[model samples]
Target chain A: MADLRINLAGISSPNPFWLASAPPTNTGYQVQRAFEAGWGGAVWKTLGDPIINTSSRFAAVHFNGQRVAGFNNIELITDRPLEVNLKEIAETKKRFPNHAVVVSLMVEPKREKWHEIVKRVEAVGVDGLELNFGCPHGMAERGMGSASGQQPDLVEAQTMWVKEAAQTPVIVKLTPNITDITMTAIAAARGGADAISLINTINSLAGVDLDSWNTIPHVGGKGAHGGYCGPAVKPIALNMVAECARSPHIHIPISGIGGISNWKDAAEFMLMGATGVQICTAAMHHGFRIVEDMIDGLNNYLDDKGLASVSELIGKSVPRYSDWGDLDLNYQVVARIHEDNCIVCNKCHIACEDTSHQCIERLETSDGRSYLKVREEDCVGCNLCAIVCPVEDAITMVEIPSTELPMSWNQRQKAIGSMGQNEAPGAKEAV
Target chain B: MSDYGLFQEEKNRLDAYISRQFKIVGITENLSGATVELEHPGGGQAEVRLLTAEGRKYMSNLVIKQFTAAN
Candidate 1:
């Protein structure tokens, strides 16, 4: 078996999968159960001043027949007492001596409050501390959670305070509910954070009950915005991770969260620059046993790829991801319909005719059989026809080799700008 | 006419000037299209407007080629 062990910054885990500091990691019992069920590590839920939580605090967006395509929650940090959580953290760490036990913390933005919490949490012999500046709901209203996290200055100051007292590695979990997540990431780096994790969650509302004219998961007939996570937010989370990973300033091990559901998702995050991945929504949907499949699938994938260790996947694709202006303008692809595999459904023809460039044409064969063919010259290769085709191999987009030299939009513009205002020859003067 | 046909017509026009020993002197691009200026050594000059994406790309390639040859 390929070595699945990973050491993110200074926190070593048997595998790269750690349970995110969410509802799943709310208690020692749950976190211990997760570790027993094959989770490599767990970040205990955010600890600070305990508060009461509402009954209707969770909602899910079911896309088509898929249950919990996206999960949203207005839930606050650990409602249990600070002593109770600390005792459990100490006990859990003692029980699973080999497993990574990182404690997540959130409190008022005071320097003393941050220092005290960091010292208290580290005293329990935890592997690391994740500063929870990313819970985006009830706590944000009190100027905690995403409130202080939104301001780069506040994020930096709180991280500095925590670092002053923290003996263990400190990870600053970043909130995505901002214009740019890299701003907070850079701030955390400046504050001497040992590592960083993203993205906490995006501000979202699940949906509304059209019949009752009330919001989904409305408590006492009222609702507030919640933090969104789960499979549907994978693209958004992946992009943010990529953005931070590719940045030059924010150089820290990333504990990627937000919509990581399975081993494939974990591998993608790792490839995009996450040193490790944290799971919550998937475990919430299908219990803690899901980590078994994740572990098995990841091991099999690593072995098949001829890699001896899972850590080899980290930041492998970062060099391939780039800005749009760097793309070659002369590179082209066109839709090609395979007659043998086609079902003659005319979906491709209709999609091309109505929406995309009019390229795919219906033609009657010599034997009077109807078929679709793409006009290679006019087909812009938008992939609309291939997307709408019901049969998988019916339509394929093939690259057309360009005879001309490659030129990007940036290069073309630069060349044009260098020419600088040349008047057309033989043009009439203003007369 | 199809977009390809318009691009072919513009490409032919550009090639015709080159065949007549005309060298590209200037190019002006605006919302309308790209206007290419060409001058022959015998003191004759001509201008052509290219309105298609392919035609503009073709014009750019020629300009780059001219730059490479000069340098």
Candidate 2:
């Protein structure tokens, strides 16, 4: 079997999968059960001043027939007392000595409070500490979670305070509510964070009850915005991870979170620069046993890829991700319909004729049967026709080799600027 | 006519100028399209407006080739 073990900035785990600091890691019992079920690590739920939670604190966005395609929560940090949580952490560590147990912390942004909490949590013999700067709903109202997280200076100061007393590696879990995530990531690194994790859920509301005219998961007939997570937010989260991963200033191991459901998502995050992945929504929807399939699938994938360790996947695709200006403008792909695989469904033709460039033409064959063909010269290769095709391999995007030298938009602009006076002969008359 | 036909017509116009020993002097691009200024050694000048993407790409290729050859 390929080695699945990973060490994220010195916090070693049996595998790259860790339970995010969410409801699943709220208690030692749940975390112990998760570890027993084959999770490599767990970031214990954010522990600080205990706060009472409401009854209807959770809601889900179910897309089409998929259940819990996206999950939203207004749930706050651990409601249990600090002593109780600390005792559980110490006990859990003693039990799962080899498993990684990182405690997430959040308190008033004060130096003493940070020092005291860091010292107390580290005293429990935990493997690491994740500064929770990303709870975006209830605690944010009190200027604690996303409130402190939104400000780059606050993130840096608070992280610095935690690092002052933290013996264990400190990971600053970033909030995605900001305009640019790299701003806070760079702040965390400046504060001497050992590693960083993102993205803590985006601000979202699940939906409204059209019949009742009330919001979904309304507590006492009222609703507030919640933090959004789940498969629906994967693309957004992946882009943020890629943005931070490709940044030059932010150099820290990333513990990628947000909508990581299965092994494929985990591998994608790792390839994009996450050293380890913390998952919650999938575990919450399917229970802790889902990690079994994740572990097995990842093991099989690594072995098939001829990689000896899961760590080999980290940051492998970062070089492939670049700005739009760097992409070659000369490269082209045109849609080609395979006649054998075509289902004779007019979805591609209709999509092309109406929304896209009028390229795919509907024509009768020699036998008077209908078929579609693409006018290659006019087809812009937007991939809309292929996307709407129901049958697999019916419409394929084939790359067209260019005869000219490869050029990028940046290069093209530079070349245009090099030519001095570009004023047309009849430009004044045309204007 | 299709866009390809327009591009072919414009490409032929450019090729006609090139066959007459006309050298590209100046080029301009705007919302309308790219306009190439060609001048022959015998003191004749002509301009062609390329509206299609292929035509513009063809013009850009020529400009890049001239730039590379000059350097």
Candidate 3:
């Protein structure tokens, strides 16, 4: 396998995959097990002055047959005492020197509090510090988390304050609930953050229990919107990461987060300009062992693609993305169905007849028999019916264009026709 | 609505060239929207239908299905 080692601002890791600061990284025990399982690094769960957590702090959304999505907590940062967390950081760093152990912090929005936290954490041999300026729920009500990140001036001031007191590298994690990600990223950069990580979950209200007239994960029959993360947020995270990477003002190192479940996802974040990829939901969903696949898959993919190093793939796709209207206008494809395999279900027929292009043609035999037919001119190439069909490979999309004329296999064979029906593949039946 | 009107209004435009392009009989086709169905010359049936609501327009993309009888 090709080399997967990466160095972000002098903090090196065996690979670019790191655990995001969430439940999985809430303690040193969890983090050590994660490293032993092959994760290259981890951001210790957000730590600050101890705070209370509610008993039932979660909700979910289901789609199709899966619990497709969810939300988290009335919980605050790591509830463990600061000294205990510090002692673990020192031990974790001493035990695994190669892995990146960046301490994530959030406290009262005071420069003195940030200054003290950075100084104390730096002494633990930690590789870096991530400002937890993006937690959207309980913490924000106290003028921390999203409160600090939302105001550009506060983002800059708080980042600058920590940078001033820190010896270790500082990364500012941004919230997705903001208006423009670029504006916040620029603010972080201007404050001298060594790098930026994003996004901390989006604000969400999971769902409602209509009879009780209360929101889910309800406490006292009422619930507030919580921060949303998991697979559902990956696209939004990717878009924000891309915006930061492409933004002219901020070109610092990036640790991408949001719904990264496997190596392919980590690789996409790298290609979009993140030097490292941080994951939370996946680790929560499948347990820490997933890092084994993440490491193996990325390494194998690199070897197959002939890339000798992880850095080779970083930000590679950034240049290909451009403003809208620059896309090619002539590309086209047609919808084609396999005849011998069709089940003759008329669901597509009824759907198309009443609601769509009215492009379907039903025909009867010369003896007054009937079947379905397609009017090619009106078919717009939507693959919806294909998705709803139960048969496998029965329907497929085939591309055709106005510029290219049609070709008939029978006509070509007829033009070269000298062979009688007696010797062909179906000749016996014809006779 | 008349099923025959739907078929003729949909297929009349493609009558001249479709048989040459795809070796199939035009069964029911709607070019204006997602409701179109066709049978390939090889005897497979294809159908198109609408699935979701479209924004800023009267239609969204069509769902196309192909089928053959199961034994």
Q: Which ten residues in a row have the lowest lDDT in candidate 1 chain A?
A: A422-431
Best by DockQ: 2
**Number of backbone clashes in candidate 2:** 0
Q: Write the per-residue lDDT of candidate 1 for residues A1-431, one digit (tens) a residue.
A: 99999998899999999999999998889989998999999999999999899989899999889999999998999999989999999999999998999999999999998888888888889999999899999999999999989999999999999888988999999999999999999999999999999988889999999999889889989999999999988999899999999999978899999899999999999999999999999999999999999999999999999999998999999998988988888899999999999999999999988888888899998999999999999988799999999998989999999998898878876776666745445432521
* After superposition, candidate 3 runs with Cα above 4 Å error: A340-431, B1-71
> How much is B58 displaced in model 3, in angstroms?
22
**Residue A420 accuracy (lDDT) in model 1:** 73
Tell me the TM-score of model 1.
0.95
Q: Which sequence of candidate numbers ranks them by TM-score, best first?
A: 2, 1, 3
CA lDDT, candidate 1, residue A56:
91
lDDT of 3 by residue, A374-427 (tens): 666566666655666578876777777544222233332232232121133444
Error of 3 at A296 (Å): 2.3
Model 3 CAPRI rating: incorrect
lDDT of candidate 2 over A172-284, digit per residue (tens): 99999999999999999999999999999999999999999788889999999999999998988888899999999988899999899999999999999999999999999
TM-score between candidate 3 and the true structure: 0.74
Best by lDDT: 2
Q: Scoring each candidate complex against the real one, what DockQ results? A: 0.47, 0.49, 0.03
